[model samples]
Structure formats: C-alpha cells, structure tokens
Target chain A: MSRLELRHMRKAFGGLEVLADISLRVDAGEFVSILGPSGAGKSTLFQLLTGAEHGEGEMFFDGAPLDDHGRHFAFMPQRDALMPWRRILDNTTLGLEVQGLGRKAARTRVAPLFAEFGLAGFERHFPAQLSGGMRQRAALLRTVVQERDMLLLDEPFGALDALTRAAMQRWLEQMWRHHRWTALLITHDVREAVFLSDRIYVLSARPARVVREIQVPLPRPRDPTSAATRQAGVLEAEILDILLNLQPTKGHDHD
Target chain B: MASSSFNPRQLAGFLAQAAPAVISIGLVLVAWELYANHSGIKPTVLPAPSRVFEQAMLNRDALLDNAIPTIRATLIGFACSLSAAFALSMLVDFFQPLRRALFPVFIVSQTLPLVAIAPLVVLWFGFGLTPKIMLVALVTFFPMLVALVQGYEATEVEIGQMLRAMGAGRWRVFILARLPSALPYFFAGLRISITYAVVGAIFAEYAGAAKGLGIYMLNAKNNFRPDLVLAAVGVSAALTLVLFGLTVVLQRLAMPWERAAGRRAARKGPQA
Candidate 1:
C-alpha cells in the first residue's frame, strides 16, 4: 500500500509559471484524478513528481518525504509510446528489462497477465497490427506490469475514439477494482474522472492551482449515463462550470 | 516469411510492383538497340548491343574470371565499411565530443574524388587486393554513418521520456529504441552504398591491378575492342544488381515486422 501527498507545489519554466501552489493527496488503494484543461500544467506536476523537473514543494509518500530519485512510480504517457518494432508481449516487459530483470524471467512473469489485460493471443502481434483500443490496453499493461507502488497516467486513452474511450474507462475501473493499485490519472474529461476516480481534483488554467477536491460517493462499477447515477451528472456539470468560468469569482481567486 | 506457404498471389503482387521499373527500362533498351543499328558508328568505337552480346558470349570465361575478383573486393570492402560505420556511429552517438569533432571529417571524406584518391591508394599499397578493398571501404563509409546518425536523431522524443521514466539508462535506450528505429535507415544506406561499392572496386582496379573488371576493361579498350569493354560494363552492372538484391533479402530477414506492418496497413486501408 502507498499514499502520496503534495503540499504547496509550484513549478516554473524560465520566467513563466506553470504550476502555482498546487496541493493534492491520494490514500493507499485509492484512484484519484487531476482534471484540468489542456496545457494547464497538469503534466508539469507529474514531471515534478517523476523528478524529471525541479519544483518548489513538499511531497511525502507512505508518511515519509518522497525520494527525488526513487523508482516507485510507473508512467503511461498520452501516446501509447509503444515501440513500433516490439511485439505487444515484449512491450509489456520493457519496464522490467530496464530495471535489469532478465528477459526470460520477465516474460515468465508477464505472459500470464496478457489474458487479464484482454491481450490474449496478441503476444506476437506488433502494436501497429492491433486496434487503437488494444494498443492503449497494451500500454496500460506495460505500466502495471512493473508492479510500481503508484501509477501516473496522462490521458492514456485520449487518442481513442469516443466509443472506445468510454469502453476503456469502464474496463479500467474493473481492473482498478480487481488490483486496487494506487493510481493518479491526469485528464480533462470530467466524466472520465467521475467514472474512474475515488476523488477528483479540478485544476485551473495555466499557472495551475487545485481549485476543488471532490469526493465520489458512487458505488462500484459506475454507469456514468445511468439515471440513478444522478450524482455523477451533477459532479460533471459542476466541474464543467468551474472549467468554463460559469461561476462567479471566489475568494480563492488570484490575478 | 519462411513460415508462409506458397501463394501465387504473392508472385502476382510482386510483378505488379515491378511493372513500372520494367516498363521504363524496356523502353530505353529498345530505343538504344534501334539507334545502335541505325547510327552505324564503328563497332570499335561504340559497339551495338548485338555485337556486345556476341563478344560477351565469346569471352564469357574471361568475363567470369575478372568478375570473381571484383566481386570479392566488393564484398570484403563493403563488409569492412559496414562494420566500421556501425562502430563509429555507436561511438559518435554515445559521446557528444566525438560527434562534434568527427562529423565534419566524415563529410569531408565523401567530398574527396575517388579517382584522385584511388591512384594514390594503389601507389601506396602496391597493385594488390589491399588497395581495391580500402578504396571501396572508404567510398562506402560516409553515407552509412550519416544514415545511422540521422536515424538515431529521428527517434521520437516522447519515447525517450517514457523510457527514462522506466529507469532505462543510455545503453538500454540505444539498444532497445535507437537501434531498432535505425534498421530501416541503415538498410537504405546499405542499398545506396552497394552500388557505389562495386563502382569503387572497379575504379580501384583501374588505378593498377593484375585482375578484376577494371583491368579487363582497360586491356579491352587498349586493344580497341570496345565491345568487350561494354560487355565488362554490363557484367559489373549485373553484379551491382545482384548485391542490391541480397541487401533487400537481408533487410526482410532482419525486420520481419516491417512486412507485417505493411500487411496491417493494407488490410486496414487508408482510413486507419
């Protein structure tokens, strides 16, 4: 189990601020999302966490200060980032190999999960041979197979079509429920956040600030379109209202 | 590819792809054959295709004998050049200072005329296989080096970011991502250099050699037997095509996924 907390995190590139005094937390076995508009410095916060960039912050993991160079997170970029040359199975084992795990051993550990990841019989198929949804699934499998304590997913299914994206969202929730991995998803789609997360952090535009932390009291296996799930729709509208500036100014406002 | 069973459709598809090249070459050959017959330039000066064919048949043994040496030089020289290019590119890729220091020297090597350099090479090494192989290696090295460098640079930046996030080091990234991405470009460089390899070997022999197509052509030209010269020319061209075909086969064997990707694209159509 792993828990992550960030307090007053800030980042800037040269003179331009990207993340400004952002704060968030995720409990062990919880699924959380940072929902923001495109280019709202959401990825910058990830970069800070990954230690790929420097930022002013206090970050703690599992009740201890986060190590700047710890190998505790698995990242899935917006693109599948699948090597065009590697087959799906080999792609899934990439992280293991990078960490000095032998190829044969890594394959032994990863081959069984192909079925669970819905990639059965695709072990030898190149990424290009698979459909868009399958490729994204392969990418997700690659992320989780590392068995990292936390997952930092940046729009993993943003490239898929609407139907595929929605289907993937449901599939992701099923996987998260089964494995209960600590996951942090970065997305702009309010419905995706509402469907897949235990908590949602709505972020403002550039020089991003965490505007709201909303809890999801919905039951498991959520159906975002269900009439009974009126709360899901209400939360989506509220988040949209914040994003679109449909609400009047508040005390938290900064010029 | 080896696992696939026989398919006549494969042959037909191959023929379809070859059609444009065949048609263009056939049109040019027919025009040349007609012009050679009508123009009536002395056979000793510019032999007609028919006359050259007769000469080629008459001296087939000599042509084959000379061809062996040229082929040997081409093969050995190209192998050395490829190995050297691979090693140097790895060095350049791994070390920034070497890349900055050596890239300009690599480009300058290509600028030196092979004709000017070949004689000096033979004069230094003496009339032997050493000079021929060295000249060929020198001529074929730069294009491959450039291809590898460009291929390394062409890797997608996001891919590297993802790999770094995975805890992969510089060496692992090179082996897994950079090397695989460069295979297609390396094969392209091989095809380009191969044609030059044969020509370079012949030029090396022309400087001074006891055997090879170059020596054979020189003797034939001295005897005013342009037909034999042209026959040797034809043989060398044929040699280049054969070597080029070998590279294509090697490429297919090395990167089977490329063929698979093509098949997927074809099946999925343009929209995909």
Candidate 2:
C-alpha cells in the first residue's frame, strides 16, 4: 500500500509566492485530481514532486518522509513526450529501460500492454505515424508500465480534440478501474477532473492554495449517459464555479 | 518506413523532380561548348569542351590512379573527425569545465587561416600523406562538434525531466532523448563537413603530395596542358557530388522516422 501526504507545502520564486500553504492527501488506491485554473502553479507542484524542481515542502510517502526521486511516482507530462525517433513499442518500454532493465527484458514486459492500450498494430510505428490520441495512449502505457507506487499525470489529455479527449477520458477510466493505481492528476479542465477523479482538490488562481476539497460520490463505471450522472454535472459546475470566481487574495498575502 | 521497395509511381515522381536540374546542367554544358567553338581562344588558356573530353578519355587510367588516393584521404579523414567529435561531445556534455574550455577553442579552430597553415603543415610533416590527412581532419571536425553540442542542447526540457523522473541516470537520458534529437543536426553538419572534406584533402594535396588529382592538375598546368587540368577538375567535382549524395543516403538510412514524418507532411500539405 502506498499513500502520499503533502503538509503545509509552500513555494516561492524569488519575491513571487507560488504555492501558498498547500496541503493535500491521496491515500492508497485513491484517484485524486487537482483542479485549478491555468497558471495556478498546478504544474509547479508536480515539478517539485517529480524532483525536476525543488521547493519547501513536506511530502510523506507511506508515512515516511520522501527523499528518493523515482521510488514513489511515475510522471506523464502535458504532451506525450514520446521520442519521435523511437517506435511506439520502444517508447512504451523507455521507463523500464531507464530503470536498468535490459532492452529485451523491458520490451518483453511492456509487449502485452500495447494491445491493452489500444495500440496493437502501432508497435512498429513512429510517434509521427500515430494520431494524437494514439500517441497519448502510448505515453500512458509508458507511464503505467514503470510499475511505480503512483502516477503523477500533468494534463495528460490536455492536447487532444474535444471528441478525442472524451473518448480518452472513458478509456482512461476503464484502465484505472482495472489497475486501481494510486494516482494524482493535475488539470485545468473541470469536466475532466469530474469524470476521472474519486476526489477533486480545487485551487485558487495565481498563488495556489487549496480552496476546497470535493468528494465525487459517483459510483464505479460512471455511466456518462445515465440520469444519475447528472450528479457529475452538478459537481462539475460547482468546481467550475470555484475556479471561475477565484479572486487573487492579494490582501491576505504576506500574512 | 521501409523505403527499400521501389515502385514505378515513386520513380516517376523522382524523375519529375530531377528533370529541372538535369535540364539546367545540360543547358550550361551546351552554352559552354558553343562559346569554346566560337570564342577562338588559345587551347592552352581555354580548352574547348570537346578537347577537355578527349583528354579525359585518353588519360582515364591516370585520372583513376590519382582519384583513388584523394577518395581514400577524404573518407579516412572524415571518419576520424566524426569519431573525435563524438568522443569530445560526450565529454563536453558531461563536464561543464571541459565544455567551457573547449567551445571557444573549437570556434577558433574554424576561423583558423588554412591557406597560411597548409604550407607550414607540409614543411613540418614532409610531402607525405600525413599532412594531407591532418588538414582534412582539422577542416571537418568543428561542424560536427558544433552540431552535436547544439543538438544536445536543443533537446526538450520536459523529455529530460520526464526521463529523470522515471529514474533515468544522466547517461540514459542522453542516449534516449539528447542523442536522438541531435541526429538531424548531426547529419546537417555532416553534409557541410563532407563537402569541405573533399575540398580540404585536395587543398592539402595541392600544397604537397606525390600522387593525387591536385598533383596531376599542377603538372598539367606547368606542361601548358589546360585540357588535362580541366579533366582533373571535372573528376574532382564528380567525386564531390558522389560524396554529397552518399551523405544524403546515409542520412536516410540513419533516420527512417524523419522520412515517415516527411511523407505524412507531404500527404497533408495540399489539403492543409
């Protein structure tokens, strides 16, 4: 079992404060989403978590203070970040290869995952050969194949068209239901957060602080077509409202 | 991506694109022939196209003999430079101090006056193959080093970050992201260096060599046989074109993925 707890994490870039007294928890087997407006320092938080950037924070992993870089989370960027030169198969196996697994061994481990990721025939194809949605799936396959403690997906579906985004959202939900990996997703899309998350953390605009945490009680295999799914719409609206109406608390700053 | 299989349609398309270049070259040759026939210039100073052709045919064996050495020097020198660039670039990528020290030196190497250095190189090394090879290596090294450095730096920041986040070490990140991104740049640099490789070797041979196209041209010049000199020049130009074509083919072989991308862009270009 793996759990992540961020306690009073604060970050400043010179004189500009980014993460102002941020704290959140994602228990084991939980699928959490951090919903925020664009430029709300949503990405900066993930950057810190992935050790790409350093900031003042207390990140506890399974009740231990986090120090190791790659032990806890596998990261997926806003873009697919698939190496254009490598075939889709090699791209998916990249994480394993980086983890010191031999190329053949890594390939073998991730071979079956390509089919599950809806990329059966694209193994030999380059990143440019595939469509945007296919590339994202390959990237997701790359992330999950690492078999890390959790996944930190930063705007995974942010680059797709609306129709493709919806389809990928459904596809991702099905995959998540099957594996049940502890995951934290950072996104500006309220609809995406509502559809994919078990719980959503809303953040204010510039100097991001958790304004509220909303639990989505939508049951497993959420029927996007069902009348009961209106509950999701309500939650989507509520989070959207929080995001849309968020005012920069400049007066409360430096307190 | 396996462009190995040929088709009639592709051949037709290629020929269509190649038609203009062939026509332009043919027109230039025809115009030169007409001028040589009418100008009534001394053959020693300006041999007609026909005379140059006749001399080339008659001296084909000698030309071939001289050509082999020049080709060998060019290939060997280019290869040495490539390997050195690869080794040095790896060191530069890893060590900040090495990069800081060597980068300015590399630029200075490019700016060095080869005209003044060539005679000095011959004087030190004697009229053997060593100085010729050295000049060729020195001339070709900098483009590749610059290409490799720029290519490594141009790699997407997120790609490196994502790899490190996956527990990739510095070496792994390099081979995965940095190295591949540098391939296009490397090939572009290679194309530039390769063109100069042939020229550099010839320049070295001209400075001093027992047997080469450069020596052949010098002898022909002193003998008042301008037709022979033109024939040697023609041979060298043909050799350079062949080398340039080979680089393009090598680039294709190295990066089939870029070809795939190009095809996709081509297909989408009209509609988009």
Candidate no. 1 TM-score: 0.93
Question: What's the residue-level lDDT of A79 in candidate 2?
Answer: 95
For every candidate structure, what is the RMSD over all alpha carbons to the true structure, in angstroms?
2.9, 2.9
Lowest lDDT sum, 10 consecutive residues, model 2 chain A, at A246-255
- After TM-score superposition, the amount by which residue B56's alpha carbon in candidate 1 deviates from its true location, in angstroms, is 1.3
Residue A44 in candidate 1, Cα distance off native in Å: 2.2
lDDT per residue for candidate 2 within A119-223, as digits (tens), equals 998789888878889889999999999999999999999989898899899999999999998999999899889888999999987789999999988988976
How far off is residue A83 in model 1, in Å? 1.6
Q: Estimate each model's TM-score.
A: 0.93, 0.94
lDDT by residue (A78-129, candidate 1, tens digit) is 9999998888889999999998899999999999999988889989988888
Q: Interface Cα RMSD for candidate 2?
A: 3.7
Query: Cα miss at B215, model 1 (Å)?
Result: 2.3
Question: Backbone clashes in each candidate structure, one number apiece?
Answer: 0, 0
